[model samples]
Target chain A: MSAEAPPAEETIASPRPVRGSLPRRLVGRPELGAVVGAVAVFVFFSVVADAFLQWSSFSTVLYASSTIGIMAVPVALLMIGGEFDLSTGVLVTSSALISSMFSYQMTANVWVGVGVSLLATLAIGFFNGYLLVRTNLPSFIITLGTFLILQGCNLGFTKLISDTVSTKSISDMEGFPSARKVFASHLTIGDVEVQITVLWWFALIALATWILLRTRAGNWIFAVGGAKEAARAVGVPVERTKIGLYLGVALAAWISGQHLLFNYDVVQSGEGVGNELLYIIAAVIGGCLLTGGYGSAVGAAVGAFIFGMTNKGIVYAQWGADWFKFFLGAMLLLATLLNWWVRKRAEESK
Target chain B: MSTSRTSKASQTSPASRKALVALSDISKYYGNVKALDGVSLEVHAGEITCVLGDNGAGKSTLIKIVAGLHQHDGGTFAIEGEETRLGSPREALDRGIATVYQDLAVVPLMPVWRNFFLGSEIHKGRGPLRRLDVEEMRTTTHRELLRMGIDLRDVDQPIGTLSGGQRQCVAIARAVHFGAKVLILDEPTAALGVKQSGVVLKYVAAARDAGLGVVLITHNPHHAYLVGDRFVLLKRGAMAGSHAKDGIALEELTRQMAGGSELEQLSHELARTPAPDLSGGVAKG
Candidate 1:
């Protein structure tokens, strides 16, 4: 039966019959068990640890989260676009080594070093995406190739430059002044100040969120990842979008490099290995499906938060840090299974 | 001459009725294969224009052209009497043309509202400063789905949570909300059951009643008979014929679609074939 239709003068606030909205559903989703898990861990540690609840502790978790969190946002987007970047971890390590060489060994200006690092990382992204689109091979193998190559480069190049696998000090290097402020600087809020990467974390999240939700470009991102054929059928530039996602991921790795290199004066050639999995874990925990077609950037940020909390929380609980991998693996499994159950319920409820 | 002929053949004459879309002489090709040759059809306001074809009959090619997924080699596509070339789905969208794809155009894991506003999101404020008007979209999505006779308890649930028929409904409602003047459905009822097909067909009429033109592509003549205002049959990449609702019979369309006499001949031949020759005994018919 056709109902009485609303007049043209109707207000935007008209009563709707949709039962629960997306935001409301997201808040109540059983799949968001990781978020709950994150909170529980936070509260549990805060109550027991001496300074865990203080702002000082907040800075550490958030600071560390900066690198991984920044990486997680784009990784989540790439995953949503139906691809993966296993090279992202080694890509970061390569950038850090590249930057250290210029600033410490080569005696180049710090800004130049940072610029070269970012450009190189972005280039790696371009190369990965280009190869993926051209060859039509699964990104797993393509990025794995990049991962191994970058890992080897990071090791071989660092040793070649300094005859060692590490750099002692970019601190005494000339012209690190302006370069350090933008990336490695700290912002103090009362007594609980930490690294400036926290700022980068927020900025990147905000930017990624806006692009994912606001722009027309963002719509294409979801469409391409969700169903590449359908997206191509609709005339979306699937290849371009895919390539850009990989590039975005590479840029994220570059940012992570900046955070890591700045926080520690000594740069190790092999530092950020296996970090690709951590970023993926953060994204998956945040609600990105590996199979593509669906994800949330903000959710990924929260997922990174979950990781940050649990990582520090375990230590504050006076537990061995080595147990970190066990907790992470368990959470990943639990969250994924829970997410599957929620999807089933949502589908079944309809 | 062809233009006028096709115009006259379509069920609702543009002069006599409101047509959402009138595609006259749409042709397409893939390599050397002439997929669609001079296909012309009109989808009238609130009426289903069913395009039926057998395997390799260019049905997919035609839908792609009409849906703005593929560029036509030659054609004049007019929406609301304004001649336009649908260069892309975005361009088609500018002319109020939208498509509800077969495998669901909706992002399965996304919320219903997000899926509804996938490419065309509702924003408020000036350009660059505009943010998604979430409340507006959510409420509008709810209200529109309900208007389409869909009763959903939550707008936030993933579209994958919905049934095939429900997903079709959501896609329809989405097309309508995006101000679609013409909605092209690509095999929407292909995977649905009888009851589910009915649900989809009902919405096709509803969309038409709401002043939109709908192109329903399917191989099922029965489904076409239920809601079609015009029927276009394709066989081997050529337009078999176009028939109006008043002039066509459902059985005849089905017979033609299934190659009625061919099936009958095959059955008769099967019956006449020796059942089993061995064992020294001929099986009596």
Candidate 2:
């Protein structure tokens, strides 16, 4: 039944590896469990909860996840490219505070402060990448050091400036009147209202997806992550690809910083802590391997959606809000098991 | 193996047909250990130049030099008869050279079509909207692999899903599609079973037929004897000898590789000398 027509091809043709199978559906993959679990959760929430189906509640989740979602996209890409950036969480806080202080304390224009924040974040990222490539150390170890240093700096400087752990309002700045609209604006569609950052979230996700699956750079990311030595053998620039991934992660953090600023209108010293690992969790749940190579930007975004849905869905179901952390832990464990199975099956089938 | 004969390129081909790759007196140093010492050889177009060496014979070092993974501490490396520098693999690829290293050159998780166009993907848009031409890549990979006698029913499969031999072919086919004028293969069939080795050997012949200057580096003289136009022997960080196809017989090649001359001498001494007679004194008693 599976036989090919002899006349169809001029020659017998070499057999290239193929991944899809229509009939079996599983195709020897292990991730079927997590996929099924996620679907079940979504369906249950949509059907049972009163506020779960409401547009505004959904928007609220999206708004909350937008920051996490943006960071998760690049983290997924970097994970696929075979690296991680631990400094991102603290860097976001540092960037936002820096921007807020520049605009309010130093009386600079909002855009200028935003620009400085982005530039500074990029510098940190580049340094992380530079040391990583040159020293040939795993990015995890290097970025961890950066993470600690940044955390200390964030606390130390915040305490020095105000004699307290938080910075005063950037909302009082002269330029804050016009600056609020670009970032803190709200969008309403029918009965749904979303923070304008959702638009940025969507645009960034779309752009990141394009870069991962549709460009030459995307191919390099896969090659480098798959096997860096082999990639170098075939003329892919391993160091450059790795550095670019770090740069991408840093850029994402900077954007997240901007979102947090516009959302809260105040900077907190302790904000965004523990969030870098959260982004990594989202990427892993999205099917990215911890070792790198073989993942999807779309999958990571979907992962963020799952997180968002559950966060709001639990409240809408009138479940105790204290159970949120437990739910996330369970979800992560399920995803990890599914992903491991899928990889093993993939190896066996090959 | 004896069924083939060289199709002599006519005088009109070029003035003194260029050496597709050349290493003149190339030497490598690893913390005072001379890995390669004054190693020199030339690879020509329309010919398969095989480098045969045993373990630690500088074969790995030489191939790394040609592939642009390592730099020579002492030597003049040239391509197309002109001296040139290849500081990075990207530079080598830019100049139409490609290397297929054993293991890991082909990404396991990426689809066959994607791996085929990796690092040089075709795009559809002019500016901000630019995106990979996925359909084009998928069909072209199918077509190219088909030409090399590899056709997958679906081009969307992860390359890791194929057998080792098939994966090597995909890497080979990728180089050919990307316009690699000179292709260097490092131990392409080292870890294969009999059937897989046969598949890979066929692909090597196919690559040569496609007009690529082929450099086959292997420790197996038998594998080299199959399609090689010329063979260069390396031993202990230096060139031992070189022979054209007509100059060396299969037995001689094996004998050389097996250290036949040294073995013969040991036997000769063993046969000529035995028991010089403290036994003779005992016989008088």
> What C-alpha RMSD separates each model from the true structure?
5.5, 5.7
* Model 1 segments more than 4 A misplaced: A1-14, A17-31, A43-62, A104-106, A191-193, A213-219, A232-237, A309-321, A342-350, B1-47, B68-97, B126-128, B151-153, B179-181, B210-213, B270-285
**What's the residue-level lDDT of A131 in candidate 2?**
99
Evaluate residue B2 in candidate 2 and report its C-alpha lDDT on the 0 to 100 scale: 20
lDDT of 2 by residue, A111-183 (tens): 7888888899899989999999999988889999999999998889888886788877877666676667877
Give the Å shift of residue B52 in candidate 2: 1.1
Which residue segments of model 2 deviate by more than 4 Å? A1-9, A12-35, A46-50, A343-350, B1-18, B24-27, B73-76, B262-285
All models, DockQ values? 0.29, 0.35
Please give, for residues B63-164, the per-residue lDDT of candidate 2 as tens digits: 878877788899899988788877878888888888898886688888888888877778898888888998888878988888777767767777888889
Among all candidates shown, the one with the greatest lDDT:
2
> What local lDDT does model 2 show for residue B224?
88
Worst 10 residues of 1 chain A by lDDT: A1-10
Model 1: fraction of native contacts: 0.31
User: Which one wins on TM-score?
Assistant: 2
